[model samples]
Target: MTMLRRNLMHAKRYPSMTFSVVVMPVILLLIFNFVLGGAMQAGVGGDDSKYINYLTPGMLLLLPAYMTAAIAVLVSTDVTKGIVNRFRTMAISQSAILTGHVMGTLIQAVLALGAMLGVAALCGFRPEATPIEWVAAIGLMLLIVFALGWLSVAFGLAAPNPESASNMPFPIIMMPFLGSGLVPTDTMPVGLRQFAEYQPFTPFTETVRGLLMGSEIGASGIISLAWCAVIALVGYLWAKSLFRKQSR
Candidate 1:
């Protein structure tokens, strides 16, 4: 509970940064939805909306990829400013203090997703099933975010400063082009295509596309769960080790 409160307080203190997260996705959604909306198509279902449909799932998955990894920068910022050392001198729960920032990232992920969904609706994507399916889809997205969040935490702690964390996402931003976000992997070079097709982001994006379009894109939905489990396990373990080392 204290973790949640501290995270929420941080969020309130940094409303502009929080707003940028939401706004960046929206801006990307519109740009993609308008320019490439008609050229993209996936699955057999009738839901063929572009930009929002194509971009939303990608945003849903990759947002955390960038957001979490970038947290290294925030952590770096706090530490470089001596805030973390100051806090360490006080009596703060080791786990709560470390995880509290992650909670803030998670909260940002949820809010940004909500804002993206609103954009999706405005652009003509609709649910064909019950709200439970929407919830389930969101749950899947959240799982990915959580897994990626830990990676961010680890990176933030391990990074020399926040600027390093800030720069970590540049390589990640290009992932969508290689995955299902921009074009079908079938259309790319054989080797790169295979990598993109098999990568974790591919499956996760496929799952989101499946949920939004009311049909399966590929075996991606199944693969997505597997990726989430593996990443969650590995990321959390690494983050835990880092947290322990930092506190020591």
Candidate 2:
């Protein structure tokens, strides 16, 4: 609780970091929902409002990827500023600082997701899922945020500095473009289609889309869960090991 409060205070002091996370996705949501929405609707065999249903789920999933860079910057800043060293000398739990960072990132990611959802609602997104499905969707998103947030921690800890840490997660921002987020994987070339079909973000987007749109989520849900679990485990272990070395 102490570390979480401290991290939240740091975010309050450095509002740009959190603001940047909200800005990029909100911009993309607007551009995609208004400018490209009609064309995309035509491409997907749906009306403007109907396309919003398909588009918004993918956008919701995409938000976390971009937010990873923000987490990377925060983590790298703490390490570079010798905050980690300062914490090591304290009597708090060794993992508290990292846990605090994970919690902070999750909270901010949820806020960013909420902003996207609000804009999406204004843009004509109305999901058809039942109450249970909505609960499941929210749980899935939280799990994804938790998983990816840890990966960002690892990225931050691995980077030599904040700038590099911020850049390390850049590929995550592009995963949506290359996957099933913006378009169907079947429309791509054979090789790209295969890659898109198998990528982590594709399953996530597809699963979320399925849940919201009343489509089948069986396979995609399983794949998404698997991907999240693997990424979270790997990232948590890597970050823990790096932080331990830094403390020593």
Candidate 3:
């Protein structure tokens, strides 16, 4: 808990980091819903004004990915500043440092998600979800944030400096754009369509969309959970090994 508090305090001191995390998604939501919404909606055979309904879930999925850069920078900053080494000299749990980062990022990610949802609501994004469905939807989003938070930790630990750490997760941020986020996968060419359909973000977007908009979830929810598990396991193990190596 101390470590978590410390991380949150750091975030509080560096408000720009948190602001960036919150602003990017909100900006994208506005741009996609306002600027290119008509053309994209027409491509998807939907009304331009109603694009917010389709875009909101994907934008929600994006909140975590945008967060990865900030989380990575924070972890990288700690390591490069010798803070992790200082912590090692103490009698605290070794994993606490990394866990603190993950928890801190999760909290910020949730808050950012809420902010994006608010902006989405103002942009005419309405959901048909019941209370139970809303709960499930939120649970799924939290799972995604938690899983990605660990991945960002690993990225931060692996990078030699904060700058590289910030760039390491760029591909993750692009996943939503390549998936069913902005447009339907069917409109793409065969190769791109297949990739978009099978990517991790597609299932994440689809599952959330289904939950909120009353569409068929089919296997997307299960697939999304499986992807989260795989990502979290890989990230946890990788970050643990790296931190241990650094300890030596």
C-alpha lDDT of residue 1 in model 3: 100
| Weakest lDDT window of 10 consecutive positions for candidate 2 | 40-49
Q: What TM-score fits each model?
A: 0.86, 0.96, 0.98
**Candidate 1's residue-wise lDDT over 81-173, tens digit each?**
887777778787766766777777777788778877787788875556467767878888888877777776777777777777677656655
Ranking by lDDT: 3, 2, 1
Estimate, for each residue in 91-148, the C-alpha lDDT of model 3 and write its tens digit. Answer: 9999999999889887887788789889999999999999999999999988998899
**Prediction 1 global C-alpha lDDT:** 0.71
Q: Write the per-residue lDDT of candidate 2 for residues 1-248, one digit (tens) a residue.
A: 99889889988998997887788877887898789988877657766778888788888877788878988888899999998888899888988888898898788877887888889899888889999888888889989989998999999999999999989998888888888777788878999999889889999988888888897777999999999999999999999999888777
| Global lDDT scores for all candidate models | 0.71, 0.87, 0.91
Q: Could you tell me which 10 consecutive residues in candidate 3 have the lowest summed lDDT?
A: 42-51
Clashes of each: 4, 0, 0
Clashing residue pairs in candidate 3, if any?
Answer: none
The local lDDT score (0 to 100) that residue 159 gets in candidate 2 is 98
lDDT of 1 at 112: 79
